[model samples]
Target: MQKPSIPRGTRDFGPIQMAKRNYIFNTIRSVYEKYGFAQLETPTMENLSVLTGKYGDEGDQLLFKVLNSGDFLSKTEENDYQVGSKALLPKIAEKGLRYDLTVPFARYVVMHRNEISFPFKRYQIQPVWRADRPQKGRYREFYQCDADVVGTNSLICEAEIIAMINEVFNNLQLPDFTIKINNRKVLVGITEVIGATGKEADFCVAIDKLDKIGIEKVNEELIQRGFTQQNINKLKPVFEFEGSIVEKLQFLTTYFAQSETGLEGVKETQEILKYLDSYKLENDHLELDLTLARGLSYYTGTIFEVKANGVQIGSITGGGRYDNLTGVFGLKDVSGVGISFGVDRIYDVLEELDLYPAETGAQVQVMIVNFGSEMTASGLSLLQKLRTQGIRSEMYPDAVKMKKQMSYANNLNIPFVVLIGEDEMKSGDYTLKNMLDGEQAAYKINDLISKIKNSH
Candidate 1:
């Protein structure tokens, strides 16, 4: 028999991991609702046409396409196989696993345009797939908890997104974090000034990897992509400068004096920060990072990425403005800005820091200790009473040995155990055991409820 194994890039979450994941999801979902956003869900598989090209060239390459059902190759000829895989994909596959939530949301907006209100604010927490090589902090399948608002160009939305980012990390009890902010317009303006007009995509892509690959390799990549040495020289100062957000924007104002677009991007960044000045930040601070280019092709205005301080993992959350995303789906001029929380990476961070509460993993608060057949009959009535008052309680099946039942409760990390043997049943009192300290005491049914309820 062949040994069973899962795909290398995927993971199977056990009960504890599921509990932690739900904690993360519920935290994000509650915040989304508090901010007046409704929950939305889209199908796992979207049309190949809908999924393609929205992500840039490299992003498109990572898409996991689904093959057509029922003898998909029956109509293909020998000539069809001669064409390369890229060329022949359309012939065999008409659908694909969604790369991210934003693109599908765009498609949803266009299809339901007539039925919904403008500037629809919706939150989605679902799993998405990619075919890229996975490593630490990167997965083939992961969940993206995204909240977006469309149909408006208000900078208030941008400020609100920053506020949301702060609230999420704060609620998660995450340690110090930095929210890096940038503007795509600023990137375009820099390209125009440096004479790399047509290479904006390449410039953003290489710069986005700056922290990963370092400056030397990024310079080499620029040359290979047709950027002149002089262009790099002119662009060198943008990477070299460092200061406070206000100071950095001031420098950009002076540097982009000749470029109208660059100056506009700076003004927009300034305005967003201005709006954030009055709001009290909880756990994060925003920074102006010119090098923070989130290389997605759809981002048209402000771009954002968040990194957890003191942790070596990549951005735990990220998103930005997509002014033209809806246009491709036949809904013109509807702009949207949003961010996504990477739940898998966040889980890894929480685990590394040991931040999860002790009670988080253990679902049952109390377990009824089964003594024997006679004791089991009376235990059921008490068990239902405990459950009726909304305590998470369960009974071990099979009236087994005392040692075996105690071992079962310990394995589950159950905090409290109730004992109802023949003596307790006749006396009309129950013995409760504190699993952590192993102390047992007798109490009436009403007193048992009070003790368990107040224990936590």
Candidate 2:
């Protein structure tokens, strides 16, 4: 038989990992619920037509297409089909694993428009697949924790998303970080002022890497993309300008004064800022970053990306406003803004910073001693009573020696051990040992449960 193995870019999460992941998911889910957003899910495979031409060129390349099932070449000559597979693959494969939740949500909205309420607020926690090469933080298969508000043009949704992001990181007790906010229209304004309108895509894509690739290389990329020296020079100051959000907005007022669209972008950003100020979260938590041009093509108005302080990882989370995500599906004028939390990256930050609660992997809380057949029965009875009290109590299956049982408990990091030998059984008591401090005491069953419940 072939040796058993799973595919690359996939992970098998064990109990402890699942527990930690559950903790993360539940925390995010609770926050999403608190904001009154309902949950929604889309299928893993969507029609190829719906999925394609949605994500931009690079994103389309990374989509995982599903081959037609059951003798897919029945209609074609064998040799000709083999020859044409390279060109005809997309046509033959009519479905694909979804790339992200946002696009699929758009498709869902269009298909179910009649059944849904307006200004729909929904949260989706689902696994999305990509065909890209796997890396430390980037994976071909991973989960996206997404929350989007659709069918409304109100900037309140944008502010709510910002506040949601803030609440999530804050509740996670994440260390210092900043939520970088920008507007795509502001990007368009920059392109217009610099005389590079249609080339806005290229400009946005290049500057999106300013954090990763630096400004020098970004300029070189712009020039390579056919931007003139004068254009690059005009756009360079917008990036190089750094100060308080107030100062930056002031500078932008003068810079984008000539362009009406740029001014509107500035106004939208200021409105979000004013909301931020009125709500008055930690002032340091939000920043107006001119360089934050998230490269995704769907974003139309506001854009957001978050970075962890003192870490080398890329943006830990990002999302933006899409003016017509559903319009592509024939549902026009339905605007939406959403955000996705990069769970894997957040896990990496927590691991590096040692912020995960030490008790995160804790499974067993109490272990009972199995002395002999009779003592074991007694121990089992006590274990049942402890478990009924909500303690994760278990006994060693074998009638192991006392020292061996103790060693087992120590290895498992079980915090409490209950000794129920013949004497303790006869005395109607059990010896509870605190593994960490090695303190031992004999107590009645009720007293033991009370102590464990109270202390632990």
Candidate 3:
């Protein structure tokens, strides 16, 4: 028999893992709902045309394409394959697994434009696929909890997204995190200020790696990308600029004074900061990070990325503003802002810190030990009553040995076990045992429900 294995970068969650994951999802969903964002779901695959060119060069290469169905080679020109698979890809593959929720959401807004209201607020929690290499906290398949608002350019949306970020990590009881904010226009301004206007994409892509590869390699990359050494010299101050959020903003304001677009980005950042100051976030801090250029080509305005305080992983949440994502899909002039929580990475952070609440992984609160066939009926009756009371209880499926059934309960960490053999059934009561303390008592159905409900 062939050994069973899952694909690399994918995972199969067990019962306890799923429960902890659900806890994360449920917490995010509740916060999203409180913010008035409606839930949305998109298909796992999207048309190749809808996905390509949306995420920029590196992102496009990471898309997992679906092959054309049924004798795909018959439709391809023999000569096309000789050139290269990349050259012949379009002739065979027409669909791809979704790379992220934002692009699919853009398509949705355009297709359903007439049916939905303007400034539509929506939240989506779904698994997305990517063809990237797998590593710790990076997966080929993972869930993204995304919340977005479209059709409005209000800075309020950006501010609220920051608040939502704060709320989510705080609710999860995660340690200190920093919400790094930036503007694509500001990056554009930086390019213009340094006289590298035409190479904005290359510039952003290089600087975005400042955190990963450090300044030396980044400067080397910029030089290789054909930027003149003199222009590169001009960018040294930006690389070195640091201090409080306000101080950084002050420096950027003076630095980009000559670049109109850059100044506008500065103004937008200031406005967002102004609004954010009115709210208090317990564990998260907002900071201006000029180097925080989200490498996605689609983001035209504000960008955000969140990093956990003490974890050694990438951003657990990220997103930004897209001015006209829908325009690519034949819808014009709509703007949107969004953020996505990286569920898998967040799971890693929580696990590493041992932060999950004690009850988050509890699947069953109680179990009924099956003494024998004679007592099975009585056990089933009590099980039904307990379940009806909204208690997570189960009876042993078969009349197993007493020791074995007790072992099952112990292994499952079931806190309470009810032993309903002939003696207890005759007395119209159940023998309830507290697994933790090894205490035993007999109680009527009402008292049994109350006792179990009140037990840890």
Candidate 4:
């Protein structure tokens, strides 16, 4: 028989893994809802037109396109294939898996423009696909937990997103994280200062790699992209700028004196920092990172990226302000700011640090031991009662041996196991075993429910 396997960069989650994954999702969802963001979901696939061009050239190259279903080859000319796959793709594929939630949210807002209120706050937790090679903490298919508010340009929206980031990591018990904030305007300002004004996009793209490829390669790339050595020299201070948030802002203010757009970005970053001061963040610290140039072309204003304090992982979360995302979908002037929590990477961090709660993977709080056919009926009724009392539970399905039933419960780390047999059934009481401590006791039916619920 052929060995069973799944595609690379994909995973099959078992019971324990799913339980832990759900914990991460639930924690994030609750925080999103608490912040007045309503849940939204979009289809996993979007039209090629909607997804293409939105992510820039490299991003477009990574989109997973779905081929036409039937007779797909009929419309394709042999010469089209001979020319190149890129030339032939549009002939066969019309749709592609969604690359991210933000773009689709933009499309949704435009399509339902009539229904949505201004400053629509929505949260989406969904899987997105990319065709890129995957490695540790990076998968081709993974979930993005995004919260965005559209139709407003207030800095409060940006501030609240920062607060939400703090809340999420704190709730998840993440020990240390930094919320790096920067503005596209500030990046644009850098380009302006360096005299790379017309090539701002190329400048941002090259500088965004400072963390990935380091400053030397970034400088080389800037040179390759036609930035003069003189202009590249002007950008060195931006790479070297460091201090408290205030100090960084002061530097930018002086440096961007010539660029109004750059100064506007400086003011925006300062305002966001001031608003952030009102909150008491536990695990998240705000920093004005001059180098944080989110490479996405759509970002127009404030941008954010999050990194785990001690873990050597790529950003676990990122997003930014987009002034014109919806305009592309025919809904003009709808400004939105948002952030995305990278679920899979966060899971890896939690697992590597062993931070998940001990009981997170415990699906059933109680398990009833099946004594035999004679007692199965009573066990079923007792199991039903436990469930009705808001307790998660189950009974051993067959007339299994006592040792086997107890072993099964132990394996799942179920806290309590109730035994129902001739004596307990006749006495109108149940035998409950505290699996963790091996403490045994007897209780009336109602009392049994109370004890189990309270103990858990």
RMSD to the true structure for each prediction, in A, is: 1.1, 2.2, 1.2, 1.3
Mark the 10 consecutive residues where model 1 has the least summed lDDT: 275-284
Where does model 3 exceed 4 Å of error? 282-284
Worst 10 residues of 4 by lDDT: 276-285
lDDT by residue (10-64, candidate 1, tens digit) is 9999887898999999999999999999999999999999989888888999999
Ranked candidates, highest lDDT first: 3, 4, 1, 2
lDDT of 4 at 20: 96
Residue pairs with colliding backbones in model 3 are: none
Error (Å) of candidate 3 at residue 396 is 0.7
lDDT of each: 0.90, 0.86, 0.91, 0.90
The deviation in Å at residue 369 for candidate 2 is 2.4
Model 3 lDDT at residue 287: 79
| TM-scores of the models, in the order given | 0.98, 0.94, 0.98, 0.98
Alpha carbon lDDT at 305, candidate 2: 92
Which stretches in model 1 have alpha-carbon errors above 4 Å?
282-284
